[model samples]
Target chain A: MVEAFAVASGKGGTGKTTSTLALGMALAEEYDVTVVDADTGMANLLFHAGLADVETTLHDVLVEGGAPVEAATYERFGMRVVPCGTSLAAFEAAEPERLRAVVADLAADADVLLLDSPATLGSKSAILPIVLADRVVIVLQATIPAVSDGLKVQEYALSYGTDVAGTIFNRVRGDVESAAEKADRYFEGPLLATVPESEAAQQARAAGRPLLAHAPDSEAATAYRAAAARLDPRDGDSGDVADRFRSAVVPDPP
Target chain B: MIPEGELLRSRVVTDLATALEDVLDRHLDGYAVLAPRETLLGAADGRGVLTFEDGVPACAYHVETDRGGPAALGDVGAGPYRFELYALEAAALEIAHDADELRVPPGMPAERLAGDPALATRTRRRAGVDADRPDDGGALEAFLEDEATVERIRESARREARRRAEEWGLGDALADRPDG
Candidate 1:
């Protein structure tokens, strides 16, 4: 069985990359998880996943007649990670639609696939992960823009026939229980976890490691683990998922 | 009600923090009027009125909702909002600022509206030294509880999603596409 989740937020600086890898690491203990940095335009997962030194990446797999998907896949922190390169020329040279086939190929072997999605819903490439995912995990901060943009993301996912797995309130400060309760009313899924802002998360990023791997005992890591537990991964035939991705109708490049 | 001052800035800002941070950094003795850019209630539905003293938030009021203080902050939900900042003499706002019922803590706007904790902390520190106003929380909860505004946000997003789906040629993927 395979379930793909797009860990997404509409706005930036919401610790999306951190939350994605943390969730990926926590879920890895229970399932064979594969994480893909689908945010090709502004790919930073390579830095976070410690794959910054990798010679090949999703960029290589995306360009025509480039590397196979397996070449870019790296086993790190007990999960399969496919990080995107940061080179502007590479990003420009890569084809966005190639992500569909790559995700499909990765979907065939993993029990869970987590797509670290782009922060904006601005372009086809940005929204494609959400459109293709079986479900989305909305990451939010208890502020107007974050929540507002989060609502926009949720609506976009629902409109595209994607289910909302749940919401993770990241970088929370003080008590947000009341706000979380109020927010849960608007979202399709439950409030999975509220991760407090932590210096450990920032330090982990600087150390080029996921929070869970760097500071497993930190409050943020614990919250991410709790979030993973609450995320009830559903059963979907990997063959069907792969075929759907391979056949998913994406618009022609401009 | 407070009297107006000279207009300093007026434009549509996607993030309220830009306006708030500007007000804070400039130490401007002024006020700002924030109105939702897209709303069935129009810009007049409820224009949020926030006053600042030395770039620290002093008081808040929602014109249409007839609510004051932190609740007014809630009335001013997500942006991009039409933000207009007006410069005022400290003497001009002195009396109006005394209305404790209409007062908001220094960091509430940054915290609740901007969702910027760093700005909130800075504002709080500035408030601690510049102004000693009592603090309160729950604007996010208040915004969420305003079912009408929340529904409006969701409704507008849904509309935008479907409209953009067509533009991006992903209309067929829409769950409620006419032909689907």
Candidate 2:
């Protein structure tokens, strides 16, 4: 079965896109992965993935009635990508509701699909990726505001009947144990991985490459691999955490 | 909401095509009517022949009746329709028409046009158009079609884009900043 994970965050600057790309690269080691830039309004994943100049994008599929397969341009590094256009015209013209169909079409070919969603939870377009996904993996920093915002995203995903796969604590710094304990307590699901702040991640972003490709030996890349391992839907352990959390919160009396 | 450039382009193209059709209806005997495919949504069918110019749907035509002509001519279905082609912008406008409602006038500002309660509710019910305030024509078209309107729309789109970009931290990501 194809498993689609929408990488989302309540607020911006949470390394959501980076985590999506990094985890995608790691998952590609064993599965056919496709990372989609579902953030139609402010698309930057193409640039991050060094595919900024691609002519065909998700905009064409959603707006111009083009085939979804035509939008998959970058097919290398054991993965593919459906990039979104940066122009305001493309964003305005796109039919956000069509994403459900697009996702369905893509599921035929990909084993793992990672959608990098927009930061905002307000826009109908922003919620589309999560609504269509089988699971949602939130990326967030370890802080009160970030945790609260991540919880909002979690609740939003749950409202749509999508499973919260887990949360990845990105850019962990200073104290690892304390951050992990705090995140475990606040977050509803499992803490997938704690990626430490590293210069290699920044360098990979600058080089427009995934950390797995740019710095394979880096700590950030290792954390991403660990996270991807946990996210593997084929693994029997990778069940819906939201269901478990729900049962725990309101357990049925025996 | 429709982009100003796209709204303007669609209006110009549809107006020119509609004017041509009106003239053809008045004069020519059994002549084919050519129009922008998008504007002629109510009329276009499987039999209509769509032609592309510069990678855009320039015009679409359907023969009223097939008058036996030269074999080569029949292949292209070209006839004495006196076709007048006008090149406008490439973008196509999505015009929503409910058989029960009055057709939105071409070139009418989107905000003013959507202000009609019936049309507003109808457009909102449609999937692709804006749900709250469907601006099919555009918001800034009330001003003179000069640099002011252009600048205003440009500024508005820029601000909107910037706000979205900031919300996603796209600027910092594009600049390769660690702060993102």
Candidate 3:
């Protein structure tokens, strides 16, 4: 079965898109992965993936009655991407609920699908991705507000019957051990991985490439690989922390 | 029928209608009577039928001069002799294609707009409107008169309504409603 993971955040500028790109590239190392830009309003994933000027986008598929498969831009870091348009008119015209069919069609071809969601809570644009995905991975900084927002998103996802896969603590500055423990306690889900603040991330962004493809040996890239390993469904020990936390905290779904 | 130039000139009449609405709402206790000069003139010409767009008085109108003169009303003679009021009606239209082009962020390449299918469609539609517009100072009239432009606006409104209904989980109920 294909595992669809939605990378979302409570607030903007939390490195959510960056984490999605890195994790997608790392996961593509061993599996067929497709990263979808589900942020219909302020889409930037295409720019980061060097497909900014792609002819077709998710807007065309969702709003303009174009085929979903036609929107996919292949061969970007050995992964497929359905980038969203950055036009306000397109944003106004799109039907967010139509993403269900798009994601379902994409999931059939790929082993893993990562949805890069917008950072808005309760809005149609943000909720559609979470509702359509099998699980959600929240990307957040190691701060009170960020962690609080991530928990709210986790709660929102659970309300819709989707599972909270875990949280990725990105751009961890100074110490890792304390940040990991704090993140684990606050997130209520597994602390999947904590990526360090590195110049390599900036360099990779500047070069319009994924961290793994730009600097394979970089610290940030290595952390993403570890995160991807835990995300792989083939591994039996992948979701131990998440399973334990879910059982302890979340009641059995009706 | 109003001349094309007169219809185009009605664009400025929006301000007069707004002013009349504001003044009447503040002072008048009940309904106010205002008639377009064309309607009065048509009545004098023995034409019984007077037509206006959507019940809005078209063209200019002044205060009734036969009502015991201006000084008979309090402070009427101290002000201007002629008062013009034009009833306003809302008209929906598509945004000009160049609107998105103008909003493109500084330092960003213009090619990105061309690559986006929806933006391209909007730009193309606006371009079509611009190309079809008459150069003889009746652009607004031509735009409103164009069947394609009016249909595009209607289609956009329908799509917007359907999209909203779907988002709120009311699509089934909306579909069950009687067709317009």
Candidate 4:
């Protein structure tokens, strides 16, 4: 019984990987967490987790005679990181349903799964994987267009009858008070968190280290933690949230 | 919601294969096509996978065959099945995360029915479509977006199929997905 959250931002550079890895570490205290490389397009979650040399990865699992799922699965801050790994192109050639099937298998093993989706819907070539998640968290920066894009996704989510957890303003700069207030008012759900822009963050990703691991005390880290704290596994209540997905209906299902 | 990694399962893999096979049969019919035993739709390295075609081809081909008979309309049975199959591949496109409209172009049948439940009212109006209003009730353009409106979608598809059947001289009653 897996409770999954899809971290989506239609626009790039929204700190989706940072949030995913940070939440992966933060959520580890309660249950078995796994980060799914749902970002099949340009997967970079592994690099953020600092496990570049991973051996038996998902790419291998897709092909014949590859390592086992246990072998491909690795530990990251008490949580497991299912490396989508290299050889991604070959897997994609297999197509969407196959990709969704593979992603479903990985999500089944974890108590909670965090999917780092690509920013562009077009980049979301692996469509089934996104729809498979129990929840979708839209991460956005402090910009009108970004929030608007996130809202559209939120509207699409309404058909499922589940409200999007809310938007997280990543890399916020200056005292944009009005912008923040307006953005909050515009959203249908909570505006979960606001992460400040940090030079340390730019440095950490550049140095290939997670901010929570590299600079735990950073302001951005604190914001991430606060946002992370809001996500209560208890609220999900014994896998009923994701398990009872049938209660949610398709949006505009023609 | 399906979890991220859950798709990697062998059992799920078989289920997906079956779904895709059904899609192939629904659209391609008698055409020789291969559904890759396994397809991967993941993304990594800053780019989504390609080769995994998510959009309907912009091209459409109308092949007239002597053996298909004058009344046969479009023959997806033999050569040039790509266009016809693509036209009937709305379900396949949905699996690919593509919201392509089979009734739109290239693959769209000349005639369409308003049998879709979502558009039951519109479906009835489009029953005997006239060409002056191309976007009229019976045209493919009149179909709604949500496929979950099972009756509307099927009725819409039926109308389009029927229209095309008439234009091409093919008879009525093309096998459409039942409302079950």
Clashes by residue pair, model 3: none
Q: Give the poorly placed runs of model 1, Cα more than 4 Å off.
A: A251-254, B39-44, B129-137, B177-180
Q: What tens digits encode model 3's per-residue C-alpha lDDT throughout B43-117?
A: 322111111222211111113332111111211111111233233221211121122321212101100101122
* Residue B30 of model 2, lDDT score: 20
* Candidate 3 lDDT by residue in tens digits, A146-243: 55456667665654556778888776543335534644654445878888767888787787777788888988889888887887543322243223
Lowest summed lDDT across 10 adjacent residues in model 1 chain A is found at A245-254
lDDT by residue for model 1 (B1-180), tens: 679799998888987887899899999998998888764356357688999999999899998888888888988888888899999999999987999989887888988788777788889898884332313337788788889888878888888898888998888778974522
Against the native complex, each candidate's DockQ, computed on alpha carbons, is: 0.56, 0.01, 0.01, 0.01
Q: Model 4 compared with the native: what TM-score?
A: 0.53
Interface RMSD, all candidates in order, equals 3.4, 25.8, 25.2, 20.9
**Runs in model 3 with CA error above 4 Å?**
A234-254, B1-180
Candidate 4 chain B least-lDDT 10 residues = B43-52
> Could you give candidate 4's per-residue lDDT for residues A1-254 as a string of tens digits?
56778788866777888888877777777778888776655768778877777766666665555556677678766778876665646555423333444555665566777888777643224222344455678887544335434654554333333346667877764354444555565556577788886887877777667788888899988888888778764334434544433322221110
Candidate 4, which CAPRI tier?
Answer: incorrect
Clash numbers, per candidate: 0, 0, 0, 70
Higher-ranked by lDDT: 1 or 2: 1
Q: What is the lDDT of candidate 4?
A: 0.48
Cα error of candidate 1 at position B55, Å: 0.7
Write candidate 1's Cα lDDT for A117-186 as tens digits: 9999988878988999999999999887789899999999999999999999998876778888889999
Ranking by lDDT: 1, 2, 3, 4
